[model samples]
Target chain A: MRIEAVALRYRYPRAASEALRGASVGAASGSSLAILGPNGCGKSTLLGALIGNIAPSSGRVLLGGRDLATLAPRAAARLVAFLPQFERMSFALSALEYALLGRAPRLGAFAQPAKADEDAAYRALEGAGAADLAGRRVNELSGGELQLVRIARCLAQDTPAIVMDEPTSMLDPAHARMVADAVRALAASGRTLVFSTHDAAFAAYAADEVSLMRGGSDQFRGPVAEALEAGRLASCFGVPFGAASAPSAFFR
Target chain B: MPRSPDDLRARSGKVLLLALAGLALLAFCLLAGRYPRPGLLDPRLLSSDATARAIVLGSRLPRLAAALLLGAVMAAAGNAFQMVFGNPLVEPGFLGVSQGAALGAALALVAGARSEFVVAGSAFGFALAALAAAALLARAFPFGGWVLRLVLAGFAVSAFMSAGLALVKYAADPLRELPDIVYWTMGSLSGASWRRLGFAAIPALGSTAFLVAYRWRVTALSADEAVVRSLGARPALSRALVLAIASAGVAAAVAMAGAVSWIGLVVPHAARLMFGADARRSMPASIALGAYFAALCDTIARAAFPGELPLGAVTAVIGSAAFVALLARGKVPVAR
Candidate 1:
């Protein structure tokens, strides 16, 4: 589904300043858009607004030409799936069981997941490269394995759009690569992707479009190549931006 | 994704077997009591003898039903508490439902309200009040997350309720009200009768049925609130609803059975170990297993000695032992 944030504004209940000051961004249907920003840049807040979690203080959000506020939560979820930041879960559900929970939006209130739901979960796990981890307890999984399982759950959600917050932020290089590959596949599968990340190179590699947010406002919004300039990156993050062609871009 | 259809089939089969075993135990508990002494009564007696039939139906049936209801309700409430609070150590009383009920009951006794209806009603009211106080307190402390804030608020209310109970006890008649308060706090089901069971059944059935029907959604409690919300769930509203229902069931159980310890705390854990932590499977398991545990405990309470043992004492010993055994076996995985 097309996601349009039309001049959205938000502030925490008791906070001194607005978290989002008239920020606007959009992603076309079946395309990948990355909200690239540094810490405390309101990337998470913007994603929250897009998903209708944080109601915009002013302006509004439209999901597929309908006011987002008008849709019921279940209907919103069916149209746009979400993958939140990783949770340090303590409960003992298997990866497969956890993934099957994605079918919750589709199931009736009193119904449990049927065989078709389980099959969908299996397919999602396979797509996420977590098929081997299906039987394993979620809490017992390593960081990479857990992230894969989480992504598999998102896959199982099977909506028209997916919104994610820092999908690879907590991962090691190898795991981050795995997540990056998964993100590309998700985008390629014709689902609108709205994600947040700090890694410019990774965003450039995965996202067709990029919107750079700095100091709680949109700094740049365009094609990834245009948004990844060194001077603009330096200003956005307050760090020297450099391109390294030393046979590896993972560290950058 | 990882599970086989055969494994699921086997589990369903196991559930059936467990249900059958639980039914048999309930029947056995009906015959095993101190009145008969040293051994179980003849099954033929249930039909042939009038006084025996009256005793079995009027007296034993109620107590047996009480045990079943107490176990299932408390276990189900305990499971919901743990899920909504996102804490493994939580129980139905962590939010002060039990203490609130005890305080309300104690006040009723001290006020010379001897009727069962008044006492149960007061207990139920206070139990719901405690939850309200916790919610209000949580709202006041908006800096933290829901689970953490609720936990702190509940602890505060629990302490206050305990103090209130103590004060009521200190002011009561030493001989009559003191013993009643003490016995009620220790928890017992000996007063179980058809009348009391009927009173408790409404809330018990309402809560358990709701929890069972919504068991799948309970999984959302273990996730981050953002994730829960993103999936089209209102975490606050959902938790509140579950807590209300669960606490109502707990209030009914406490009002009926008298502060029965350990079952509410340990039964859900046991269910999780035997089945996976998914509420869908473990919830039904909790109901069945709780009934079995309560029946066995009640039988031991009735049969082990010439006089009936307090139902609370027997369950405490068994529940703790099972908890320790579960830990030793490494099935619980309760990391500090």
Candidate 2:
């Protein structure tokens, strides 16, 4: 599915300033787009808009050519899956059970997941290299391992497009590289991917195109090579962006 | 908790066996009560003796039915509440449902409505009202997260209803209404009649079936909002569905058994320990196990003493002790 956010404008209720003011970006079918921004640049909010969680104050989003507003919530979910920043849950569920929950969109209200669903969930876990974690409680997993489980969950959703917010923020370099490889595999399989990150190296490794957001708007949208130039990167974050400023291979 | 398919199958087998064992216990309790001698009845006497037939058919049957229904209702309701709220500490009681029912029944009795139908109906009505009030108050707080807002609202409503119950008790005629209200709060099955059992069955059994039917999707409610959205389910709507169903079951149970505690909070966790945390297994596990536990406690309450003991007191003592033993064993998901 080709996801297009056409001039999205959103303001959190009673906030002093708008979180998104006419931000717009688009990803072609099976393409990966990297949303690069500093903290509070409305990247999460923009992702929220794409997933239909936050209604745009003006403008709109679309999947392929159909307006997102017209798609029922479950129908939209069948086409697009979303992963959020890490959060904890009080209840304990195994990784396989958690991943199989993604199939909920496909089942009828009274139907339980069958063997095929469980097989699909296991396939997704293996795809993300999390098969060994299938029986492990999600709450007991390390942050990086949990990220793999979350990716597996999205894979199980079987959507054409998947959006992830800061998927590598809690990972070590090795795990981050693993995620980059998985993201590449997902894109190579013809799934559209969009993710927000402050890590320029990870973004460069994973995304084909870049959308640099600043002040709640898309400051630049094009090839990552051009949009991630030192001058523009510095301007967005108010920090130096030379080779030394980039995330090091050893550590950030 | 079962991890593999084989283990899961084994756990299901174990659950089925436990259910059968519970049925046997119910039969034993049917013949064993404070029937002058406080012992099991002769099997042949049931068919030949009038007194044995009356005690077995009229008294033990209704009490056994009441125990089974109330126990299964509260524990399964608790399982749903824990999943929907994503907190092990939460149960139907945490939502003010019990307090609301107590207050409603107390007020009805104070107004000279002695009929079981009136008491149960009034209790069910007020229980729904309390849940509605909690939801409304939570919605009013638009800034905080939904889970936090719901917990805060529930706490406030529970306190308010409890105070209302106290006031009703204080204003009642000290000789008659006060004792009755106190007895109801202590939770006894002495009033178990066929009509009362019938009154509690619709909501109690119906809600349990609804929750068990939708058990898989209910896991989404325990997840973060993003997961719920990703799964294409409405978090608010699903959460409300779970809360409403569980609350109605608990309201009916409380109305019938009056303030029976601990089963809702403890048995679900025990089910999670044995069957894993997924509601699919744990919910049915809760139904079977809770019925056994409550029936056992009721048997002890009726037969272990010269006079009838309060069911609530016996359950709390045994329930907390069993929970402590489980915690000490170091195998279950206790609070997480």
Candidate 3:
């Protein structure tokens, strides 16, 4: 599915300022778009709008030419999946059970996941390279391990487009690379991926394009190389930037 | 774990075993009460002595069924409430349903409506009202997330209803109504009869079936709202529907039994301990376990002493003790 947000405008209730101000971005199927922004730059809010979690006050999100607001939640879910930045489980669930919850959109409201759903969950776990972790309790997994399991859950949703909020945040470089690799693999399999991240290195590694957000709006959208230029980086972040000093430059 | 078909089978088998054990306990309670003597009533006496037959069939049977029904409904509703609210500490009691029922029954008693049907009906009606009031108050509150708002709202409503119950008790004639009010608050099945049991069965059992059938959806509600929303389910709508159903079932049980405690709070914990946290397993386990706990408590309440002990007191003592033991074992399964 092709997800495009066209000039989304959103303001939190009781807030003095808007969280999103005319932000727009799009990602085609089999391509990946990385949204890069500083803290409080509305990256998360824009992502929420695209995923239909938040209704944009003055703009429409289009999923394959269909207005997202016009579509039922189940229809939208069948086209796109989402991964939140943070989650807490009330009870202990096995990794497999957690992943199987992704099949909920496909099943009846009162139906349990069947054998085929279980098979699909295992496949998703394997695709994300976390099949061995399926037996582990989700609460017992380390931060990186849990991320892989969560990614597997997203894959199990079996949607063409997946939106992730900080997919590689709060992880060591090795774990971050693992998630980047999973994202790359999913993109290679023709899944549309949109994610927000501070990891410029991961973005350059996995994303085909970059959208730089500033002050609750998109500042620039282009190829990653041009978008990550030192001049653009310095202006976007309001900090001094050197080619050698850039994290992505060093990693590259 | 990669739960195989065998694992699912094993869970089903465990539920069946629990049901069978509960049936056995019910049978034992049937014959082991203070019937012909202080001990077990002879089967031959049941066949030959008309009084013995009448006592077993008329009084003991209905009372035990009521106990079983009360425990099952409370536990099942507790399990649903805890799952739907995503809080192990929450139960039907946390939602003001129990307090509302208590207040309704107290008011009915004070109004000189002495019949069981009128009292239960009033209790059910007020219980639904309390739930609706809490929901409305939560919606009107401009602060906190949905669960937090509802929790605060329920707390306020519960306190209000409890105060109302106290006023009803205070204004009653001490000799005529006070003792009866106190007894009702303590909860009992001593007044259980066929007519009353029939009245409570529809909502209680129907709600339990609804909960058990939709157990997975209930578990889905416990997930983060974003997750539930992304799965094409409206978290707010699903939560409201499940809470309303669970509270109604609880209201019916409380209406009949007059606010039995502990089954709602403790039985689900035990169910989760024995079965995994999956509602598919824990829900049915809760039904069986709850029936057993209530039946056991009521049996002891009636047969353990010449003077009947209060069912609520017995459940509190035993439930608290078991809860402590579960905590000491360090495998409670509840996580943040």
Best by DockQ: 3
Clashes of 1: 1
lDDT of 3 by residue, A1-252 (tens): 688999999999998999999999999988999999898999999988988999999988999989999989998889889999998878777788888888888999889888899889988999889999987888789999999999998889999999999988888878888888888888888999999987677788989899999989999999999998889988998897774543442143
Q: After superposition, which runs of candidate 1 have C-alpha atoms over 4 Å from their true positions?
A: A249-252, B1-5, B45-52, B333-336
Higher-ranked by lDDT: 1 or 3? 3
lDDT tens digits, residues B228-335, model 1? 787777789988889988988988988888878788778988888778899988888888788779878987887778887888899999999988887788776553
Error of 3 at B304 (Å): 1.1
Tens-place lDDT per residue, model 2, B1-336, is 224788768976986788688768978988787554668877788888888899989988899889988889989998888888877877778888999989999999999997878987888889889999998999998788788899999999999999999999999999989998898888989889999999899989999999889888777677888789778988888888888888989998998998889998889988888778888788888988888888888989888888899999999999888778877786445443
The candidate, 2 or 3, that scores higher on DockQ is: 3
**What local lDDT score does residue B277 receive in model 3, on the 0 to 100 scale?**
75
Q: Sort the predicted structures by lDDT, highest score first.
A: 3, 2, 1
Off by over 4 Å in 3: A243-252, B1-13, B333-336
Which candidate ranks first by lDDT, i.e. highest? 3
> Candidates' lDDT values, in order?
0.85, 0.87, 0.89
Q: What is the lDDT of residue B183 in candidate 1?
A: 84
RMSD, each candidate, Å?
2.2, 2.3, 1.9
